[model samples]
Target: MTISERPVQSRQDYDGRSPFPGAHEHPAASRTQVGLTGAIVVLPFIALVIAILLAWGRGIAIADLLLAAALYVVTGFGVTVGFHRLLTHGSFTTRPWLRVVLGVAGSMTFQGNVIDWVATHRRHHAFTDRPGDPHSPYRYGTSLRGQLRGLAHAHLGWMFADEPTSTPRYAPDLLADPAMVRLARAFPALCAASLALPFLTGWAISGTLYGGLTGLLWAGLVRVALLQHVTWSVNSLCHVIGSRPYRTRRHDRSTNLWPLALLSFGESWHNGHHSDPTCARHGMGRGQIDPSAGLIRLFERLCWATDVRWPDPERLERRRVDVARKARAPAGD
Candidate 1:
């Protein structure tokens, strides 16, 4: 008989698979260095200061006001309904054409592409207020100095740092779509058009070069700056200060600060969202008045969205009871 049999292999010879992707998965940050993050941050305050000075000196005009209002609503909703509640959290669904339109309009705001945005956001949710969280205000622990550092990190320092999430791992669904790829590639052009559109409209409406210039400054630059801060504030202020009326898990420090409710487009209802991440509505309580929710309802009515995950009273009741029990638990004395 054959004496040429090979030795049996050890069990340890086969390497176990890791849940994360390998080298081919993630592409590096696309040369869009966040060096401009600091510049963008500082420049906005300067723009605001300049705006105040101009307004005080009677340099403001009716067209400037109109353009500012228009851009604020457009880009603001684009981030809220498009980038945030829709794309990042999958709070709702939309039709094919609407999806492309939202992606394009959202790119005009010059936030990162949908894939990166969703990736970072998923990481944020995966480790909220924990060490690995992309932007956690609780990273430094609960001391005064630590909270200060954590707050700064949560606000804008995360962008200033180089801790980007891998899109292939966190946002494979988004990255696989060709429509999103086209929008991401065309992002710069869309942003340029966004800036120029207001100016063109102002020029056409007012029939003056000065109107176009002011529109670019006010509606274009200033608008971007303002929206950026509002979006970042959700990562910063919302974490630090808010009312946790709903029953999110104990470690999750999400709250609903009423003052920022409107500006954040129902996103300030943090506790509700943390409790049910996939539900289409964050502002689940009565009288919350979520404009984004209203828009989602419109999409559903128009057949642009199906399978909408609206809130359920029974689930909400069970959650509240669970929270109440935990709150009343006796200390281990």
Candidate 2:
């Protein structure tokens, strides 16, 4: 799972009613908890370094490279399309079986169990960059020193903090779904399978234990590390460095960082997302490649997804910064 399922109180005064459900903040994570979180963040980088060193010794296998790419696409889409778009935002409707499949695939990303993932994200939207936000890069003030520290906090530090989002308050729908509950409970097993699948496939293909080990390092650990940082960068860099083409709520600093678009499966279109959270497509502008939206379109064609929330041109036009600015200009200007 993620943090405790236990209801916890808001830690700071909010703009309105607290999004978090309970009384006082949960205690700081215990030393053992922090240690585990560190391992999750550090071990993958360690594997990446070892993989590079091993590649230097002998030319890397094509099989390992192919496996890494394949697994990365599957697991990455699992998070971007399934967890973030479908479950968290209801960007579209899908068959129950497909929902289960998507949830299972997302759980393999090791981000968190499906329930906790949905809960935490809902709370993020409810409070955004303000005080109740669980991982805003602006957690500290916007001073240069604070910005640097908050970037770290948003990128990889907040997981070690003991703050708990209330699942009942933020994600009771997921909790009520028995299939989703089972999938959430299966998170640990799904993670094991995520690592094992690559190793087993490489071993079967290459007929060697060395091949399996290499696959585990590259496709398993290294792949996880890359996805984790890319996802976290959306939380950190997307807030700090990029263009804001659409108008969002006050103090919501989400931006669209094109450099990260391809790697993030179009999730780097953060400004579009923050502006229209329920839209199936985040890449609302021309030439904004959105692989996740493409996948959703494919699902629609296959009758797997319906009621897709495609972008509304008029609504989007209204939210454009230039449009809003023009609307406020004097009639005689």
Candidate 3:
């Protein structure tokens, strides 16, 4: 079983108290940390504004859009396939070099380093919608007012809470891997390269500094912002909205938000994923488009990935929630 598939302790519903010892939010982030997070969160919107202004002044370059699309696919997949499935969930195995490649690519997206990202996500599964979940939208309470506040918390506010997930406790395996350790330590450099690559590419291609600036705006800042929110939406919106065709653990309100499938590279099949955390494919149902899963399949075909834990039909059938029974189920907290 994957690390995430390990048995998790059950907990009572959240009742405005700590779920575990020392579970309370830490002190507010340091000024430097807050400023850094602000840059990560707010700079993209600033880039968007500049992009709009530039669009009005001179139509957005087709080259800029294309470069943005390319980087989005690369970095986005680096998270979904690399950091998430391969590293966090152990959904498949790849050769050593590809593993480091994926790790570096994901680090560029301005998410935390690979180790911290995996640790936080593993902790999320261990606690789910309960009080211990790092980013659960149900954090505040079930009331409308609480849900609103919790949504904000889950979407981005939690980053400022400074609640650290201990890497040694949650990601010991990564720490033991020299390649991952080095890659995790190089996170800042990778992020800089992530931005610089687009600018340099645009400059090289167009032979103009203006081209490079626009590339940075759209491909660098805007791409990071868009992917960040789409991933965050899986944390905040997926739990509150969307249909739940599969039964997850009690209080685990993960849901399948289709609108996010393409943008999130199929990671938004949240309910399906929560049902079988170790499965490689999140979009288990027919007609559910899952680009990440498709990419994994491609890697497997190319002999780059193996031991892929594709969904088992019989197992899925066993986990499927009967529609009639689900209708009688009480509303989620």
Top-lDDT structure, candidate number: 3
- Cα lDDT tens digits, model 2, 1-333, are 334544333444443222233212335777987997898899998998888998996988998989998888888888999999999999999999999988888888778899988998998898777766788777765668767877888898788877778888889888889999899989989999999998998789889998898999999999988898999999999988999899887667899999999989999999999999999999999999999999999999999999999999999998888866747955311
Of 1 and 3, the candidate ranking higher by TM-score:
3
> Which rank order by lDDT, best down to worst?
3, 2, 1
Task: Judge candidate 1 at residue 254 and give its lDDT.
Answer: 70
In model 2, which regions exceed 4 Å deviation?
1-27, 323-333
* Model 3 per-residue lDDT tens digits across residues 51-92: 889889689899999999999999999999999999999999
How many clashes (backbone atoms < 3 Å, residues ≥3 apart in a chain or on different chains) does model 2 have? Answer: 2
What CA RMSD would you report for each candidate? 9.4, 4.5, 3.9
What tens digits encode model 1's per-residue C-alpha lDDT throughout 1-333?
Answer: 001211212232222111111211222332456556666677757867776776786767888888887777777777778877788888778888888887777787767666677778887787565445667776655568767877787887777655557777777777788887777778778878988997898788879986787777788778888777777888888877977666654345776777777877777777788888788888878898677788889999988988888889899887663556657864210
Query: Candidate 3 clashing pairs?
Result: none
Instruction: Tell me the deviation in Å of residue 63 in model 3.
Output: 0.6
- Steric clashes per prediction: 0, 2, 0
Which order, best to worst by TM-score? 3, 2, 1
Provide the global lDDT of candidate 3 against the true structure: 0.87
